[model samples]
Target: MALKWVKDNALNLGGSPDHITIFGEGAGAASVGFHMLSPMSRDLFTNAIMQSSSPTSYWAVKGTQETSARVATLAASVSCPVSLGDALLPCLRAVDAKLLTDQQWTLVNRWFDVPIGPIVDGAFLPSHPEDMLKAGDIKKTNVLMGVNLNEGIFWIYSFAANMPLDKEGATDKEQFRNIVLAIADNNATLQTELLKVYSKEFADAQKRRIRILDAASGDSLFKCSVVDFARQYTELGGRVHLYSFEEKLTSNPWPGWMGVLQGYEIEVVFGLPLNNGSTNTQAEKDLTKEVMGLWTSFAKTGTPEFGEVEWPMYSTETEDYVKIRTKGTTVARRLRSHACAVWAGHQFP
Candidate 1:
């Protein structure tokens, strides 16, 4: 409805309906994926840019029974009677909105678990996202999708204050294993496989342990699924420009240990450094221009080809992706191939 409204009134609003490009980050990025897959949203947008999320990500959708269970739990928390069937909606509607919103966090079983998300409603979703992708049931459009180098640090730092870090503020082997177990849902085989994939081989034990945990968390939660989506989409003959946000800005407020954290690309994508009263370095400002140009150019031409670096179309064989950096953008192959293969073996949903 929203997209239709925009399309219907684009000329009246001094915009072109024929040239819409939808883009978002995190959940919003997942939403762009949903729009891409949804029949109701077909022809609403000509291109999409998904950053750090994918519709096929494990947390992006829940099984129907699980979604219903979560809704019942939420309703129970607010004294709404879920057993009342049709009455439940009104009961939930009667509850204070802020109170209902506050109860959502209690539904989380793990740091990465999203209690509320899209479901296979047989209408909007039509089928499982993975199934849809496999059958090529998604809209054929230009796709731009990628993730950050250390996406997991965002989640780790969220609970870091309550976590037990060493004097050097790094994770130990035991702590790292515990984190991998949580990410693997306490499955021993999966945990062992994850540990092997992100092995503790670095000479520095502190950095090794931390990096292991970070890689496990980031790959399981974001990168692998995004890659899977790209591969599936490309196999279906869709144009995809894959990328990795590798730059950690000098003006980054997070600890130096959190390398290229999730959502860090937002600043450059939106030209935050070029804003008034900004203290970003000249290099960052230049990078921001380059990034914004790529995004706008993609929206305008369905290709992010700008400047010296030639961004290649992703394929299952090559799995090429652009590494966006403050120094310069360069093409890289097989982003996390080994780790993604490990995840590919595991069944999601």
Candidate 2:
């Protein structure tokens, strides 16, 4: 309805309905993916740009049973009668909005679990996102999608902050093992595979553990799904230009460990470094301009190609993408092939 309203009023708003470009970052990007797959949203947009997300991402959608359970939990918490079925809506609506928002956090039980998200609704989302993509049921549009180099670091930071830790104030070896087991759902085969795949050669046990967790979390949560989406979409004859955000700015406020964290690209994409009060370096300013140019060019022309950098269309054959950074943008192939292979058929909980 929001997209429809925009299309309906584009002329009065000094925009063109024929050139609508729907773009988003993180969960917003996932929403863009859902729009592409939803029949009701077909013809609503001409192009899309998804940063650090995919419709098929594990946490992007919830099952009907799980969603119902969450709703019941939320209703019960606010003194609403869950057993009343249809009566619950009015009761929930009567509760204070801020109270309900605060209680939603209690629904999250694990590090990567998202209690509230899109579901397989009969209308907006007719089926699983993976099924839709594989069946070629999605609206074909020029798409620019990619993930950050260290997307999982943010999760690691969150886990360390929220989850219980040993006296050393770090995730011990046993704690790390247990987290991996929980992530693998206690499947012995998967546990072994994960340990083998994420093993690091670093001599320091703590450093090795952190790096392994970072890689596993990033791959399972973001990188793999984005790659899989690109492959599936391209297989269906959809044009896609994939990318990897590798730039880490000196002005970043987060700990150095959180390298190229999720949502970091937003500032650069919007040319924030060029702002009047920004402390970003000249190089960052230049990169911001280039990034803004790429984004705007794509929004206007359905292609990100600008200046001397040639971004080849992503495909299963080439698996090509441009690595955005301060040094210089370079073409890299087969992003995380080994890690993606390990996560290929398996769905993370």
TM-score of 2: 0.93
lDDT to native, each model = 0.85, 0.85
- How do all models score by TM-score? 0.94, 0.93
lDDT at position 173, candidate 1: 62
lDDT of 1: 0.85
For each candidate in turn, give its C-alpha RMSD to the true structure in angstroms: 1.9, 2.6
Q: How many clashes (backbone N, Cα, C below 3 Å) per candidate?
A: 0, 0
Candidate 2, residue 218: the lDDT equals 85
Which candidate should be chosen as best, given TM-score against the real structure?
1
Kindly report which residue stretches of model 1 are placed more than 4 angstroms away from their true locations once superposed.
Answer: 164-169, 200-203
